[model samples]
Target: MTTPLRSLFDFNGGVKPDYHKDASTRLSIGVLSAPTEVPTELVIPLHQSIGGTPRPIVAVGEQVKKGQRIGDADGDVSSAVHASTSGTVSAIEMRRMPHPSGLSSLCVVLETDGRDEWIACQAFDHKLATPQEIRDYLRDCGVVGLGGAVFPTHLKLNADRQGGIETLIINGAECEPYITCDDMLMRERANDIVRGVVLMREILGAKQVRIGIEDNKPEAIAAMQVAVGDCGDDLQVVVVPTRYPAGGAKQLIRVITGIEVPHGKRSIDYDVQCFNVATALAIYEAIGLGRPLISRIVTVAGNVDAPRNFDVLIGTPIKKIIAACSPLPDTNRLIMGGPMMGVEMPGDEVPVVKATNCILLGSNKIFPPPAPEMPCIRCGECALACPADLQPLELYWFSRAKIFGKAQEYHLFDCIECGCCSYVCPSNIPLVDYYRFAKSEIWAREKEKSLADEARDRFEFRQFRDVRDEQEKSARLAARAAAAAAAKQLATTDTVAIPNTEASTEANEKAALIAAAIARAREQQVTATPQNMQQLSAEQLAEISAIEARRAEIREQAKPHLPPDA
Candidate 1:
């Protein structure tokens, strides 16, 4: 059985703005039919969530089924992207995104085949799956928080790191003015939301589940009460006072649980975690029907003849949504969300992504130009209206002077950019704009510093490598020279006399010649030519004369032949 409602708590500061929610929530959510004049092509940006951009898996000209995975999750922090309807992949290229910055991102453009066919899907039972398995399943289903932040839902469900979660705070407090998507969702699908909440309670193993909805949404409150009563769980629907910025995660946590999450500390550190009502319903859809997050309910309001909400596909252009609403002829500005925290679109041609909850069309009639910014009068009104209990005036001064460090020290990032300070500023100063500029500058400088640090690391490593290489080269050369020296020393020490290879070879040749000459001298006897004639026998002397005669004859013959030839 569910427990009684807990005592409500008050946050630091908040404002009561003119709630323009009735204009859109008066009627039930409208179902948009397929475009008749032209085929509605969905341009799903890969970076719909708050983490890394998903990689495109479907290429141009490839056929994709409705609910088919077109983009795969990039990392643990990212969510997957699926086709909104069965279609042919037309173009996977850069297209204008639905962000206030007016920059482009990689988008998968799919032209609907008009059949709205579906791929085979299997429903999942959370009881049968492990915690990690459920998380992986949610990641693959492209489920994320639909509450403006669009953070991946799987990461939020990781309670094991938090020493086990104590409570699960469901934020149904749609406190932002003119945003009725969540309010209407709770009213129409309260049972589904309760089921999703139960699933979350099971996932977190929390002692209790408290859904914080603003008291302003009575219909939603009644519907949720009925659903919870029927479910018979300890899910308590706590009604919080409707105030601007009460829907913020930390603020909602405080109002519901009476715990102020300190700056730089996550809510889970306090044994608590939070999720949005719309995000819960998305979780239910993902697990119950195996459906991926391809579409969402967008509230189209402000300066329109028929301000209503529509169940829009993920990639429908804002222009088509405005056309459906019959926007006023004087409409000049198209904002992607509520006026308090919404981003003004550069043009209506941008496609809606997961973070888009409201498309507020405004003109001079609805949102007149702001009063000229004046010098700060040192009034404390901005600080009084700040929900985070920050000194807006001090933040403004630091941000205006580009002194981002001081602004951060004053908890500028905790400001939430809720525009409460700006709304209450008497000087009409765009205090939120200054804060945003300061934050952006700080981020850019941090990025630059990070890159510089990486470059320095690489340079230092290169220098170390060069020194090591030089030392190695010197060592190798020294080793070679030492080896040669050792060889010479060994040769000198091992031999009695070092053999002079060239001199020894020459001496041996000379000795060999002398020996041969000596041998020839010993083998033959010689005598003087005049004295030897007396010693010669008569026959021998005659033979010698005959021999001389033969030699003279041969010489005459040779001389005649040689002269004739010449």
Candidate 2:
């Protein structure tokens, strides 16, 4: 009897293109020699993965070795970066990078010394390390998905253990056209890849390990089967049907295990964790040899005299790789990865980063200029091809209208920009491009909202301070009034008693002196100028006499309270 259809969920809507695998799959991967004209500058971007950017550790003019830690992972999600070669840091500044928009990114530049010496490194015993320890070690080694995603591998491995992950899915399906680095690795280093898979199984405590390879590469499948012959029944090698994007973690998981990772959910939720074959091999290199991820296998193809796969060091310029391949006569478009998901390079100055898997130097003869884009006809072809099961036409309309909120209602964020919809569209409309536009608009609005929230917080804090100050001022005033009232009451209650004999004698003498002085002053004033006397009205003269009389009375009263000597 024939074997059952291997792939469980045969999701429809994928293109069958001329996969030029023979270009690099047949040739053994060769180690690229360091260029004689070593670049004085190396632009190493900080954000080489999906999570937080690594923090740079080296300063300008600092000397470093090939494996020296130039940048460190800031958090559990981030990945570290090691020096690709022994060199002095030339500059740490922003430069053009390998991105779709050709945006500038902060990069670390190095001037090579041609020594290629390694720094002191340490290897950890995988058997002795705890799950957390293994995760941290892998992160420090800068192990990310060698597949185009560049997701931190440690983050995927350290997913919730309580979820009870039972299966480890190893993706060996190099489905992208004109890419064969994974195929070469599987054919040559199957044993190392299996060892890496075993190590991951041990770290995750998985029950079964399933190695999925496309049927197109029978040689790789047979090679891997022989390598894992004695690995026991727990490790099984299965041949899956050849399908584009079958290597996607979610798609591969669904195809092999019939379990779909829910929207906004992880593969661990389905009791499965997927890892790339290259990533597995890198893990083996990291744990077994104590070597950090400073280089990777790159497939250089497309319109060249010779197409080959090379284990190229990180930070090697794209121009150098093309020159090594013997420059193409008619270069049309140069992309850093597969044409399906790769980005076009503005120039050849951009360096090969950790995510650089394949470099395609397309010629005009091989890849003709794309036809002019026409308006969408709303034929629903894009929606049918969307792997995420989204309405691409609606998203396209909302995105063109700049209505990001409405676009999000239809799950704009879920679009992976796989270009499957655009590929299948009859009108040749760039549907994924519209989705990207909506996503960026939403992100910009969110950033603005965050700034507004901060400003509001500062205003509220200022108002609170003003209210506190006013309350404190009122409290101080009340305290001062209470103290003054208490002092007044004390003064009124505490009185001095006067002796009767001394009081009478003191009063009599003061009255006599005052009477005599008043009589003399009155006589002198009457004989003086009549003008001065006339200037004083009847009310003024009466008021002055009353003040003089009151002063004499006060003196008489105080004399009784004074001592006998006074």
Q: Which whole-number lDDT from 0 to 100 does residue 207 have in model 1?
A: 86
> Candidate 1: which pairs clash?
none
Residue 413 of candidate 1: its Cα lDDT?
A: 83
Q: Across residues 1-566, which tens digit of lDDT does each residue of candidate 2 receive?
A: 11235545765455666788897776788776365545555667777888888999999999998878788998988899888888899988887888877888888888888877788767779787777888888899999999888999998886348644788999998888899988888899998898888888877878878888888898899888877885544687878888776777777888888886767888887789899999999998898878889888899999787888888777777777777777578887788888777778888888888899999988777777767888888999877777677898999999989988899898888777777887788887877778777898899999999999999999999999999999999898667555544454455456833334856535544554466569899999888865665777899999988998999999898875758697
- Give me the runs in candidate 2 sitting further than 4 Å from their true place: 1-7, 33-41, 230-233, 476-566
Quick one: best lDDT, which candidate? Answer: 1
RMSD of 1: 17.0
Across 1-566, the per-residue lDDT of candidate 1 in tens digits comes to 34375688889778899998888988898866344422468788888898898999987999998889998999899999999888899999999888878899999998988888888888888888877888889999999999999999999987345445788999999999999999999999999999888888877888878899998999999999999999878788888999988999999998988899888999988989899998999988898878888788999999899999888888888788889888889988999889999989989889878899999989998899998999999889998898888999999999999988899899988878999999999999999999899999999999999999999999999999999999999998667555544555465566656456867645544554566568678766453256668888899999999999999999888874556557
TM-score of each: 0.85, 0.81
